[model samples]
Target: MVAMAKKISKTVLSRTDHLLEVRDFVSEAARQFGFSEEDVANIVLAVDEACTNIIKHAYQYAPDKEINIAIVRNNGTFEVKIKDNGKNFNPDALKRPDLQRNLTHHRRGGLGVYLMRKLMDKVEYNFEAGHSNEVSLVKYLSKKQSLIKK
Candidate 1:
């Protein structure tokens, strides 16, 4: 049997206020691809964290910046690509916080990349030739292995 596929794309301003809109759009895309409610919720959460980081850290909540989000479902996998015209970043190099130090300081930041890695089957960052940067998040359907296995 031929696997099914779905694709959707949108661009939204990179502002903290638009984070909820981004989540709603991601949820709708996952729903259309026939993902379970639970899986769809996870996808939305991961994407939300990613966009939140982009808007807050990368773009610094710049109202003029734009974030392009592409949602695709193909070959039994759900994927989301978030492109931003902001400073490039290598999420791979992000250091995990020392839990002890964080607890001592009572810090409430720096968990976005970690959460994205935990929630998605594939988390990748791309620094293009120009100012555009992209973060790709993928989650497989129930039959696929969990991403946490490493």
Candidate 2:
């Protein structure tokens, strides 16, 4: 039998101030899905990075814009979909940062996208015409990462 998936969603202004609230929502959702503290932290960070990019890069700090986040968890995987209307991004066009070069040059950006890719099992992007740019991230839980009571 397949386990049921739980879903939660929230829409907030494209403002940096709302990051903490988004983190809180992620934490609560992860906890309910029986994720370990470490897993929750990773999920929260990845989502935060995605949201930060949306607020700063996509929306360009446009206060009137909004970001929508949808989180869903099924049997062994958790996923988050962040959608925005301000602008579209091509995730496939992004390249992984060279750690040595970036660290040596003290580069500030690209790290978030790298970390998001490393920490999550999957990361994808989709653009809907005249609708939204959606970035989706998924993480699979190992036995050790799950907090579910057997």
For residues 62-142, what per-residue lDDT tens digits would candidate 2 score against the true structure? 887889999888877889999999777665676787888878998766777888998788999888885589999998878
- State model 1's lDDT: 0.82
Reference-based lDDT, residue 1, model 1: 50
What tens digits encode model 1's per-residue C-alpha lDDT throughout 19-46? 8888898888777666778888889989
Tell me the TM-score of each prediction against the true structure: 0.85, 0.85
- Please give the lDDT score at residue 123 for candidate 2: 90
Residue-pair clashes per candidate: 0, 0
Residue 42 miss distance in model 1 (angstroms) = 1.0
Cα deviation of 116, candidate 2, in Å:
0.6
